[model samples]
Target: MVSSFRHHRRGFFSTLLLLLAVAGCATFVSNISVDVIRHPSNPSSSLPAFHEAPAFRNGDECSSSSATGRVDIVMTLDANYLRGTMAAILSILQHTSCPKSVTFHFLAARPEPEVLANICTAFPYLDF
Candidate 1:
């Protein structure tokens, strides 16, 4: 019985490793241009506007201030995950003790002006 269990465990690990390798080898291609539409701000909108932290105002000289207690968040944005991304940003801002201390860096696959415009519209006070 122990030998049988060991064999099954080995097979399971092998399958898991195979899946990991396949997933690692998979390539994602974005052929379509992402269209970003800025949703009009509603007073009742669930997402709150996050304020910019005062520590980031020194124009890249503020790295020293970051040691005090600032957090940096980087995310890749695309049309495919817009809603979920928005939700996540909202959740982060809403739940954080110091929303202003968070800096967001968004990396988009393509140069989408509308995406940046929409992000600015959504989080006008965000320090990007």
Candidate 2:
């Protein structure tokens, strides 16, 4: 009976390990799928890039120092990275400070640059 009990324990652990291995594989595959946004045929294709520009009030210089508010800088990325990156950015933003009104700009690249630029520019402070 003791030997049979030991065998049962070993089998249970083996099954548990198998399930863990499968779970680990699924996680790895999910991450790989997220990192692959562009086609493998053309890695040279450039996605629209975003930049932060200083916001200015009317009659204020483009590089004005009159702007006074907390600048909430949110660097948007592909939705795939959104979950993890958002958490990280939020943590940093919680501790960081800036002197301009905070805003969020989502950047993406479809088939045209103009469309992407338009979307990015629609935000109060977005540069593409």
Candidate 3:
């Protein structure tokens, strides 16, 4: 019984030491510093390029009944930021009593299918 207990204790302690060593190595590797390149204008540069949202001509079908009309503004902003902005606009629209118009323009240098789809999903009224 004593020998068995001693053997089990040695095994348990060896396993524990191995685990601690692995943990320490992992910590050391994770703590190693990495340099990241950052530009002074990175924040502004990350923003998608801007262009004016085109105006739609009023047609016979476009009577003022539309709750809100959307125009694709040209920009490189991602869906996450776009969603946040839309949420804010939506909140304001919900709180306001007066007839308010909420519009989103995708101001981008180039057309982005994913971004457009994202915007459309967020705002059903988005007009491409």
Q: Number of the top candidate by lDDT?
A: 1
- 73-98 in candidate 3: lDDT tens per residue? 33445544754555554554454343
On residues 58-122, what C-alpha lDDT tens digit does candidate 2 reach at each position? 33322344355435454555534434444454444344343233355555543444434434443
Please say which candidate is ahead in TM-score: 1 or 2.
1
The 0-to-1 C-alpha lDDT of every candidate, in the order given, reads 0.65, 0.49, 0.50
Span of ten consecutive residues with least summed lDDT in model 1:
27-36
Tell me the lDDT of model 2 at 119. Answer: 40
RMSD (Å) of each candidate, 1 decimal: 12.6, 9.9, 12.9
CA displacement after TM-score superposition, residue 114 of candidate 1 (Å): 0.7
Candidate 1 ranges with C-alpha deviation above 4 Å = 1-67
Model 1 lDDT on a 0 to 1 scale: 0.65
Worst 10 residues of 3 by lDDT: 33-42
Number of clashes in model 1? 0
lDDT by residue (44-125, candidate 1, tens digit) is 5433333322321233333455566688999988755666776777778776766667888998889876556656766777
lDDT score, candidate 3: 0.50
Maximum-TM-score candidate: 1
